[model samples]
Target chain A: MNYLHLLDYAGVAVFAATGALAASRLRLDIVGFIFFAAITGVGGGTLRDLLLGKLPVFWIKQPLFIGICVIIAVLVFFTAHLVESRYRLLLWLDAIGMAAYCVMGAMIGLEYGISPYAAIVTGISTATFGGIFRDVISGEKSVLLSDEIYISAALLGATSFVFLFSMGVPQIVAVFVGVLLAFGLRAAALLFGWTTPRYKPRQGRKIK
Target chain B: MNYLHLLDYAGVAVFAATGALAASRLRLDIVGFIFFAAITGVGGGTLRDLLLGKLPVFWIKQPLFIGICVIIAVLVFFTAHLVESRYRLLLWLDAIGMAAYCVMGAMIGLEYGISPYAAIVTGISTATFGGIFRDVISGEKSVLLSDEIYISAALLGATSFVFLFSMGVPQIVAVFVGVLLAFGLRAAALLFGWTTPRYKPRQGRKIK
Candidate 1:
């Protein structure tokens, strides 16, 4: 609850940067870059608020959040070529945003008195849906469709927070642990090239 | 306005049917079909409601819309092979839904006292976004990305409604006129293979 905006703001900026980077890869116009940035920065929270019945959403009530995104996204557009391996930078920034947003989403859900399971789902959605939107629009493969341990990391963080908080852990302690676990898992996957096992298709449809 | 649900229900059901047909193209499981159906049926309105600050969304308050989608999607799943040309059928159904949804969305937007321009955009978004979701997830080319007059049709419908209503026309007459124009434009495109002009690239970038 305390200082929530710090992490949320940082995460949104990072996500918006990823969107600009995505536009750079496609050599899109400046408007494309800004559109991508704004969507990536606020898309997740918008969906979460819709499902959670938070009227007006965060950005509408507080235009400052979107202002932050647009500024950062525009900045990224001008500085995009300075960075090599834009994909790698995107991935890393996305991981950081994922960890921060996941914790924040779960915290908000818990504050709303929703069931832990739904809260966990809300966290995962808030963390990953923006990336999904970015990937979809950019024509890049989505992290969700990848073999990488993307969502599972967010899942771990959300579950850890819900579990720890229910077990009498202090709110700040639970939040830190959740963010740490999520970032740790995601970073480890990136560092070690870890992947989840793919689903095996069944042989035939004989029962039908 | 007297029976708003009639058009909305028909449009949603048609959109859901198209989703089921999309899943059938991939021969996915029943779960996949249902998921696609639910998303395609409600995705546009969900985005609109979020932006319009309609808390809990229509489906959350009135579960019957979702129930209709689920039932229709399941039915299509079992009988998909019976259709002669699933893709063509999907396109036609989507066109019909697009026209109905475009007018309904514009009407709702006008009712909310939003500006005519925003209301027109809202109508186009409500009509086409569900199809966009369906196409993106199914790996089919989105109508938005195509040269076809997809969004333009919805645009015409929405603009027509806003203009007619503003001119003191009867709401019922305006609604019918909007739907007819949208459907007519879309149908002509599908029948005659009409396409919007492709974007031409500008020459060279300015020196930094």
Candidate 2:
């Protein structure tokens, strides 16, 4: 639980930084930057909570998360030059965040007594869908679709969490294994330049 | 029920056309056009359904909406010039779509036996949120938060729907009254250049 809490906080920090960095590139006003940062930090969790029928929302209930995200956004705002290699950092940091979120989400679902299959599905979705949404809103091709290993790795990690839990393994061991697997898979994909095949229209599918 | 179905179809067509028109402005590919159109057509309703605990998604269950969106996308793709004055047409067409969707969403909530207040909230959300998302994703400032009466009109309409329903009015009459109020309000706003005041930073809350 301690490790999970730490990782979740880390994930929030990284996601907030990514949002501020992206919004900065667009030369958004401070309010817009804050809005984007806040969205990136809590959007996935909010969506997950909404889907799971959890009320008041995670950030709404724990305003500390929102405060943390704002602080991170402000920090990034002042240190833009210091974080010049934003894209490179965003990629690796997001990988770590995704890994952590996958485990956290799956654990939360399990805690709520949801079915194992649904828990895994929700966990992976909570880990990756926010990035997908952020990219979509930013008018970029969703890395979730383009970067095949991202979502797939989260799914794998979440499924492993469920599997290990079902096998009477300790939560600590299950989380450790799940996070490592997701991080490992994502890192390998990045290092090896792995990609999914791009979707191409078939002959009969083109619009007239 | 008959009027509701008609309104749903009308809203779908208007939303799809507006989405396709917006995509054309970006000089996007056919796939992007289709994607945008489909998202515009069903995005709000899907969100409403998800929030209300409806599953499988309405569009997934009804392929007719998808087919229509695709057709609209194709039409706008080839006849881009036909939508040259997009901003003007978009406003009124969007109003119609908004009115219809608000009523339908509210009715759905009522059917599901949710609180009237929640139903009204869902209705307004369903009516305006897709456009908000569509604008945000395309890098355009969301019209909902801008100097526009968009969301407010939806709220007014939704409120009217609830009021009339509670007054023992026929369902069709209630819907008609709600839609007319929304449509008139939006048209007035567009013609008169009415706008909500922009949020200003509080005095002494100095933000850079």
Candidate 3:
């Protein structure tokens, strides 16, 4: 299998782990865990494919992806109590998944002949949307509302890939650099408490 | 335009209105209103098209639908205070939109050669997913978790449509009957405090 395909599987697995962790936090039933895992694992790619008009979606065509999500969910469900710092583990796994998906999504967008700007948007969407879907369905506060520069990391990765590819870099090299940039940035943010500035209400504004 | 086309426009408008109402309740800014409206308006149809592998998504091809969502959002933002009961108005509008979209979605599924069961699922998803997306993004409790029998209503509509069509009923008649069934069920549920039973934990089960 190609590197991209390998990254895709790893991304799906880690994303599914994060989803299972979220479900455990919510104390949802096993069905909920599976549902969350499947959705989080495939939601972003599904949206991207739909937007690009790609037929059958990636997961629908290959049921193995969903089977993997289910297996991960079952594993998480059975062993969640044994894990230390589940939330921390989830964040790290999600960061890695985001980096991989960002590069993959941008590459797919380029293959589909989308403009660079739209492709970058697609990449960011692919990286963050599954988490958004997971958080929303589980009724948790979305990471989008957090001060962490999550989307920005995805943006950096996608832009790096597109720019490098435009400059005639080989696909494998471009993908490696892109993934490294995103993962490095996200890991740094997680480790060092990096955050973006929040919009503050001006005096006498009566912010709602 | 045909009745299906007319219902599609109405569904989009009413769903957008419900989204705007949700944003207003959250005291979100104008941008939030527009964002919610656009997502809720197109969210269901987008999912349906994606599942059926339909290309270019309906709203992407016709920007007018998104434009209408924005216009409605702007109007609602300016005029929300005049509304006597926003939630009640929202529920009613959502009922109508759900009814229309349920039949439309099932018809589209049949047109795409999907099996009856899967088409019914598509119909339910089309009717309810946009609202779920809206409520989730707005951080409101979803109607899906409510006891209002919402999905059941959509299932009734879709099944009615598919069964009638399979029986050689005309498209217009099937659609009309289907819409009426869904709307009537939802309206009755709203008026009479109808509710489905929730799962109760068994003694000694220690349900998580």
Give me the candidate number with maximum DockQ.
Answer: 3
Q: Which candidate is the best by TM-score?
A: 3
Rank by DockQ, highest first: 3, 1, 2
Instruction: Give the per-residue lDDT digits (tens) of candidate 3, residues A27-143.
Output: 555645665787798878888887788776776466677778889988888777766677778899999999999989988999999998888999988999999988888788886
Better of 2 and 3 by lDDT: 3
TM-score on alpha carbons, each prediction: 0.60, 0.58, 0.62
- Ten-residue region with minimum lDDT total, candidate 1 chain B: B198-207
In model 3, where do residues sit more than 4 Å from their true spots? A196-208, B1-46, B55-131, B137-139, B145-208
Per residue, candidate 1 scores C-alpha lDDT tens digits across B95-146 of 9989999998878877876667667766876897898889888888665544
Q: Write one digit per residue (lDDT tens) for candidate 2, span B1-208.
A: 5767778988988888778777877879999999888888888898787766677778889898899889988987898787658877766777788988888888887787766766776787689767866786677756554455666678778879988987899999998999899888888888897664433222222222
| Best of the two (2, 3) by DockQ | 3
Worst 10 residues of 2 chain B by lDDT: B199-208
1 or 3, greater by lDDT = 3
Instruction: Please report the TM-score between candidate 3 and the true structure.
Output: 0.62
lDDT of 3 by residue, B37-120 (tens): 989988999888888888678998999899989999999999989989999898899999899999988889889877676677
Q: Report the lDDT of model 3 for residue B140.
A: 85
Badly placed stretches (over 4 Å) of model 1 are A196-208, B1-43, B50-128, B143-208
